[model samples]
Target: MTGSNRPAVSSGWGNLLSGANLVRSLALSGGVALHAVNLYISTTILPSVVREIGGFDYYAWNTTLFVIASILGAALSSPLLARAGPRGSYVAAVLGFIAGTLVCAAANTMEIMLAGRFVQGFGGGILLALAYAMVRRVFAEPLWPRALALLSSMWGIATLLGPAVGGVFAELGFWRGAFLFLIPAASLVALASLFVLPPRVEKRTESKPLPIVQLALLTLAVFAASWGGMGANLSSTVVGMVTALGLVGLVIVTERKSRHRLLPAGKFELPTALGSLYMASALLAVTVTCTEIFLPLFLQELHGRSPMEAGYIAAVMSAGWTAAAIYGSGLKGDRRTSAVRAGPVLSLASMATLAAVMPWTGADGDWLPLALICTALVTGGAGVGLAYPHLSAMILHLAPQGEEDKAASSIMTVQLCATAFGAAIAGLAVNLAGASSTPDDMDAANAARWLFVTVAVAPITCLVVMNTVSFKGADHAS
Candidate 1:
């Protein structure tokens, strides 16, 4: 599976797109799409939900609790899959999602909505984890890059559907309907799973006990960061972040020493390939959150755009990512290496560009600034896309013996954790810069500058960390 040993040309898209694999592919991609679209829909309709339910102070908690629950669900996926089998696990996840969506649809208060969101996030996390874990179980090695790319593309699809669905429902004064819409979508995925997925894994083994201690530490770390970011002042936010970091360090140490491992062995040692890959992946994921979570707000408040317009504009980043991922999946050898190396560079430049331009208010007729903003968004997204599939493949390639399922499931865990951290950091940056839920133009501008500038460090650090990842003996072939 190394670069030198792999075929120059893979089985090609046809192999994955046709026959029995096609149904399986749909099942996997559909799971991710369900999760992603729900995310976008929730984000878009949240303003309306708050306006109606009156939990403006706890706006961020919706995402915070959901993501924390998602981390737990992701950690639990491997064991669930082992015990329940593919079909059962997928069905269980879908049922959970449906239940949560129903709860949100019926919620009369912010507290109820937060509870529903937590349940929804847990199911979404399991869906995401199972999709990645099944990639290895169901497909040939040659198709992994393409499969991963396809899964990544679901975000792009969500970017298109989420805003429209949420916007329509919100505009029509029926935001609850938006949550209701997810029920049928999830049911279809469950139906497909019953038909397409195997009843059980072929070589199933005894399930390991859950890593309770490490899970507790990881949960505390994310919760601390999230709670801190929600603090009323900067000092509390800093303390929360510091505490979160300390908790994360403790988790790393505990993971290293524990027999019931959450991540693969050597994951904490940066010099090791697995360690470097995980670090690079986490950093790239962090860069994404810094801009994406707040882009619509900045566009609407500062640039005088409509909600729908801002939503589509924000989606340009996902479009770029999808295009680049599809293109990058076809590369091999030196070209692939070049693409990987270029990812962080592009992201860094994009962040820097945003830091400069996003803070400035433009004239009514000024389209140049808008153009630059779109360009930067695309560049940053493309950077992550180009490198992500290759990095994922490398991790799977380098995973320790008999731990492949854990490695695959942990991909979602790492991503969710990074996203939570990034959101927390972005919250801190914006709050410190005086951007509240309803900020004045100047406050919004300052928040934009501070947020992008602060997040710019992620890509820079990713660039450094990625360089240390030796691709020797790693798979790069599409």
Candidate 2:
């Protein structure tokens, strides 16, 4: 999404945060924060979970299943909002999340925990997609940018608060309690939403049926990759990954021809801006998932860091992403274009640096190398922060007249699908490199290296896609 030459629309925090808008703002943003906080908390507690539940091999499946379910949830949001309206939709999402968290808190086995995560992801995805969709309906057009900013700020808040809560619980040896804590937070959001959000509006035929077949194919692809990694030998692993890749190809071809398309028109066509934007966004998201799903483990295992310390260190990436997104929102013309081009380079460099540095077991107590790792994490996040909003804005701007809402909501669908695939692929890489079969420290280090090195290709490919985007007429419309 190019933000090169659009005329500025006046929107300020004051206008967005005042009067009736205040309650509306809270309901929408609170849902986003709840989802984000749950994500960070789950990340922090997962290492402890593997230690207790004995599912080290299924580590990435946690994220893969959750993200896959989220794709289904995001895909259904438009129809749900249309039928259920804002208040009904909000309450339903909260209830679903509550049910999932309860299962997570009480689970005694890894399979049960994964099931709970899938349910939670489905609920959270609806909330996320709905929040974005509601921005246009709930706020004055001038205040959209500010409303979006307010929503994004929730992630930064989660980066601070979620880790603190999870770290405290992890340190106290009560990681299960962390999942339970989210129940009350979600309940509070539900109460606030029921009170503040408007009643059910009449249903319209504006939204189409959910693309269930496409979603099923996507899910099968991720499941195949993840299930392959659980095999006893490398041949099975290779077959699984190859099958997943093949299914991905089928999804692309099918999506282009489907009546209910998963992405906007021309998404599979790379030379055009929309296709390139979708590709870059999905690839960058995939690259980042490798870090999110495994970085805490690497820090704790390889660096001998405490749970609290590792959680915060991992959060540095998200903090950098949040800060840079806010900063990049104001860029114009050449600066904006430059940031877009530079983003993939930053991501590529960061992943490559991690590959080289993470394999050194001696990096444990060395502050110099640790600081460099932190720098790489932040730089990797900065790449995403710089380009995401701009890319999203372009998608919304370029959508055909009747398909505008679908296009807006599909952003999350695309990102979530990429995340699901990335997590599975990361699982495959580590499993093949021998993370699951051995407890040797060197084996874990080698797996980390393999994971980072393999994922670097995503960002490298993204750079090529970004370079091909034509921003000529993009600014003219917006």
Task: Identify the candidate with maximal lDDT.
Answer: 1
All models, RMSD in angstroms: 2.5, 3.8
For model 1, the stretches where C-alpha displacement exceeds 4 angstroms are 1-10, 435-438, 476-478
The TM-score between candidate 2 and the true structure equals 0.87
Q: What is the C-alpha lDDT of each candidate?
A: 0.86, 0.77
TM-score of every prediction relative to native? 0.95, 0.87
Lowest summed-lDDT stretch of 10 residues in model 1? 1-10
Q: Please name the candidate that would achieve the greatest TM-score relative to the true structure.
A: 1
lDDT of 2 by residue, 252-303 (tens): 8899889987666787888877778877877876766568777877888888
Candidate 2 Cα errors over 4 Å, as ranges: 1-9, 46-61, 106-112, 140-146, 171-176, 192-203, 229-232, 361-365, 434-436, 439-442, 475-478
